[model samples]
Target: MITEFAPAKVNLSLRVGALGEDGYHPVDSIVVFADWGDALTVTPSDALSLEVSGPMSQAIPGGEDNLVLRAVRLLAQASGQDAKGNISLVKEIPAGAGLGGGSADAAAALRAFNRLWELDWPLDMLAGLGSQIGSDIAACVWSQPLRMTGRGERIRLIDDWPDFPALLVNPGVSVATGPVFAKFDEAPQTGAAFRPQGDLIGALQVATNDLTAPACAIAPVIDDVLAALAATKDPQLVRMSGSGATCFAIYPDEAARDAAAGAIRQVQPGWHVFPIVFRGVSAITPT
Candidate 1:
């Protein structure tokens, strides 16, 4: 049996562009992974089978439509290999919290199956196959901090990224990505690319999530969550991570982040407040 980790994705900086001729949305954003996320295990089997279990597993579908299954099928067909295995998904990331939970699961499956089937494919090769399953899959395959553009197929690794501490808070609500993009198109913004400043906080000050406004329109609770994070005495920057509902605040150090998370949890007990150290291009270590 082989086990692979599916880290929760967080868009440290997301900039959405106009709809493309292919009917896909162009996006430029910085994606990060959380050390604490879903996990998947794969073992050989005569037939493809899947079992889902975890804190957030109930919210995920256990069928062919699941991204994990689709990823396996796509890779098998593309590689001309038999797609037979027993796949188990242990979901920890929120389903529709703009955390790229499903995408990460699919990426993890691809990674596991590549080795399970002895494909010995590299990250780029696996990411190419992942794009067929979903746009986010390509980015999730790397599971690191990188710039995603051109409908999320483009991946550029970032350098000299500061190790900022982050607090991710979800107001126990789900925000669908499709609707958020649709709303953005209804009344689009200038939608420009992110320009990095000398410092992380400086760069963050200029970058923003284009889908935040529309997302708030769809789910008012998202606005409340943002306000709550913003109220934190003095966070470096507070904004919606992706689309909506799950907002993050970057701090100068881990101590500050933990304090902020604890204070928010005390006030919004129902919210899912997580304190993590943002290891850019790496995994977020939980506090």
Candidate 2:
């Protein structure tokens, strides 16, 4: 059996542009992976089947629409090979929380199958196929810190990224991405092109997630989540990770992050709060 780890994809800074003539929103962002996420395993089988079991498994669909199945099938078709595997997935990331959980799962499946089948396909090839299905898959396939642009397909690795101690929080609600984009379309921001600043923190402070306002409008609890994170002691940066509901705060160290997590959990017992040391891109090795 071959196993793969699907790390949570976090967008530290997402700068979205207006919908273009191509019917896609252009985006510029800094993305990183969290230490904790889903796990997937694949073994040879006469038929392709998937079994999902985890804390968040009930939130995921285990049918043809599942990204894991789609990714394996796509890889098989593209390689002119049979899609046959007994796949098991343990989902930890919540769906529709803007963490790119689905994409990360797909990427993990692609990588696992690549090894299981002895295809030896490189990351770029797999990422190219990933982009055909979802915008975030390419970054997830790379599984490192990068600057994503041009609808999230284009990526440039960040070599000098700093290790970030982070606290991720979710308000026990799922916010769909389509509606948030639709809301932004009603009144999009008009501004000059986005550019990175001197340092990571400075760049993140200057930039912002363009979908935050609309997401908050759709899910008011996101506002409360952000407020709670900000109220924590000594957070270097606090913002919504992707679209809504799930927010994150960067702290000076792991102690601060852990303290913030405890404080938030105390106030909102039902919410999902996780503290992690987000390592530099070079240090993020696949497990």
Candidate 3:
């Protein structure tokens, strides 16, 4: 059996532009991964099968629609091999919260099959295959601090980013990405290029998510979550992640992040709140 980590992906900065000819919105964003995420285990099998467990597992689909199986089958067909496995996922990240949880799981499966099937394919090959299925898969496969643009396909490393201690809160609502992007007012042809300056943390202070407002418009609870995070003591930054529903607050220290989580949980008992460290990996971990 082989196991791989599918870390929660966070968009530290997301600036979306107008829709392209392909009907996808172009975006300029900075993405990172967290220590908190799902785990996928694969074992040789005659056919593809999957089982999902974990606090958030119930929210995921168990049928063919699940990306895990899709990724495995796609890799098998593309590589001209009959790759089959029993993939077990311990899902920790919330779906539809803009954390790229599903994409991360798919990427993990691709990495797992790359070894379990003895393909030994290069990282780029896996990434290319991943892109066909989801926009975030390539970035999640890399699992590092990336400056992502062109609908998330074009990626470059953003080095020396601080692993800011953060509090992620989801107000028990899922916002559809399509509608959120559709609601973007006067969407431009493309977002301006991002230029990093000064300290990474300080640079993030000015970075923004253009989808935040549109997401809040779809799910008003997002505003409440943002407000609650703002009330936390001395937070460095509080903002909505990805599109909607899930929001994050970066703090000066781990203590601050934990404190923020506790305070929010006390009031929003039903909401999902977690303290996480945003770590960046330089390469993929294949097992």
- Tell me the TM-score of each prediction against the true structure: 0.95, 0.97, 0.95
The better-scoring model by TM-score among 2 and 3 is: 2
lDDT of 1 by residue, 9-97 (tens): 88878888778889888888988777678889999999999999988888998777888999999999999999899998888888899
Off by over 4 Å in 2: 282-287
Cα lDDT tens digits for candidate 2, 11-122: 8888888999998899988899888899999999999999999999998987889988999999999999899999999989999998999999999999999998888888
Candidate number achieving the greatest TM-score relative to the actual structure: 2
- What shift in Å separates residue 66 of candidate 2 from its native position after superposition? 1.0
The residue-level lDDT of candidate 3 at 93 comes to 90
TM-score, ranked from best to worst: 2, 1, 3
CA lDDT of each prediction against the hidden true structure: 0.85, 0.89, 0.85
RMSD of each: 2.8, 1.5, 1.7
What lDDT is obtained when candidate 1 is compared to the true structure? 0.85
Which one wins on lDDT?
2
Clashing pairs in 2: none
lDDT of 2 at 239: 90
Error of 1 at 248 (Å): 0.5
